[model samples]
Target: MKEFLTDPHQIERESMRIIQGHLQLDWTEQELKIVERCIHTSGDPSLEPVIRIHSQAIEAGLEALKRGALVITDVEMVRAGIAKKQLAQLGSTVECFLSDFQVAAQAAEWGITRSMAALRMNKERLKGAIVAIGNAPTALLEVLELAKDPQTRPALIVGIPVGFVGAKESKDLLWEEHQELPSITILGNRGGSPLAATCVNALIYLAVKREI
Candidate 1:
């Protein structure tokens, strides 16, 4: 699979092709316009063109899904009972689900940075300290699960955390849960958040770009 940073339009086009190839879905012109608007507003071409939703995020997600837009949403959105049933009814129409684990992971990474910053008593110095300590893998898994489609098999699973209660366990659970899938790529206990996020983002960028 090819991976590179590209413009939003390019990513959107490639994503459209990938979804069509994998799921046999087509985007209406209006749907494409919505995506373009989102991309334009976001102003980050590298940004994944996901229809994100919280509780209220579902309306937008549903609209996007109907229009052939790829969705990346949390479990709460489904649990809220807003559009979960309808979304599932789409039948292979929705492309991805970013579980709580994914959200927690991303949050944990930020928490770690924040914690380290507090410990150092300086936000500006945190990056250097984090770099000196190396990347944490446990943090990476959380974020990945958040961004990854639990339905689509993952190629790498990196678990990098220092010493947080339940952090390692969570990653372990993720690895165990998906162990049967050979597409998984897992990093050992030594992996760090920075590395994990970078790697995961790269993989996701490739996944969206290649339409995997």
Candidate 2:
């Protein structure tokens, strides 16, 4: 852990090369990078079948990201995992609403989890941005609800929060309630901060790999 911790890029690349030769993930070359990165992040091969994406989500996400849209996350860890060097070159950055002081105040007032309140507070910013929720199902649920407004809709939603309670239900609701929103989702409780962050980083990596 110490060796890789100091240089994640080297570890990630080396691991992916080894893993790629052994198991074939079912995705386009572009999409495969994201899956491979997620697996690399979690060290979980079982996630190959669980990570789900709409046919057009990647392309749409790529287009939005290429246009230099903001990447909004539910937590700070998700924001931190983004490749800042690559994103800086593209003139984009990651943001998380959860840490804002107003979110806590609003959460208390509204009787909602801070994640949900943070998302609600950032509705304007969420518009046309990439929404990545890693730690909270309430965040995804709020995003799905916000998407009912055409203006509040995100460019792409990464909905793979980890938990048994409301996690599966939140993703299912995103699928059932708002079919119009473009999204990447892990179709079960088997997801986490690393997996969610890797998806965002993967998109950024794909967009900037050749040039970076």
Candidate 3:
């Protein structure tokens, strides 16, 4: 039998120590925090190289959180994984419409995935909000389309949908074509809800730290 670390804080500290030992980049403090959390969630330090953050993403995300911006996610898993209490403390909120009946109906009517429909339906709410997409390339693509209109543009885009389909292409388009948007993303089909959630949680933690 293996001896397991039962204390959560101790386990996290140990994990961070190991991750820091593996990190090679000279990332900024804010970038480092988000990268560390994403790596910690995925248990993959090698992912550091492919993780891309726009120059303005951290500051944009932080400022939005500071202003009590709404954090919208593509799916409930991402929303559920976020730090709800901490976000509430910062006067921010997280939401997911993936499972909503209206979203389902809209998806059916539009011949699209629920993720895309959810984003489309909530376009107005996206204004100045943080949009985190962790499960669907279609949703990320839809966001790009919605962003063409200033009224629906989000403050920061966390686009890390995992799949072999359009995931890589969607992210590539976001990183390359939408350089003007404040964003964070993995360059390949190597992301998930946990990674997305941890990224937001890291930002929330940083926001709280700034207040202390």
Q: Per-residue lDDT for 48 in model 3?
A: 94
Model 3 local distance difference test score: 0.93
lDDT of each: 0.32, 0.83, 0.93
My TM-score estimates for the predictions, one after another, are 0.24, 0.90, 0.96
- Weakest 10 consecutive residues of candidate 3 by summed lDDT: 203-212
**Deviation of model 3 at 107, angstroms:** 1.5
Query: Model 3: per-residue lDDT, tens digit, 77-188?
Result: 9999999999999998899988888988889999999999989988999999999999999999999999989999999999999999999999999999999999999999
Candidate rank order under lDDT: 3, 2, 1
TM-score pick, better of 1 and 2: 2
Q: Residue 163 in model 1: shift from native, Å?
A: 3.0
Residues 100-152, model 1: lDDT tens digits: 23444544666753222222222221111111111333333433443244433
Model number with the top lDDT: 3
Runs with alpha carbons beyond 4 Å of true place in candidate 2: 1-13, 21-25, 210-212
Q: Is candidate 1 or candidate 2 better by lDDT?
A: 2
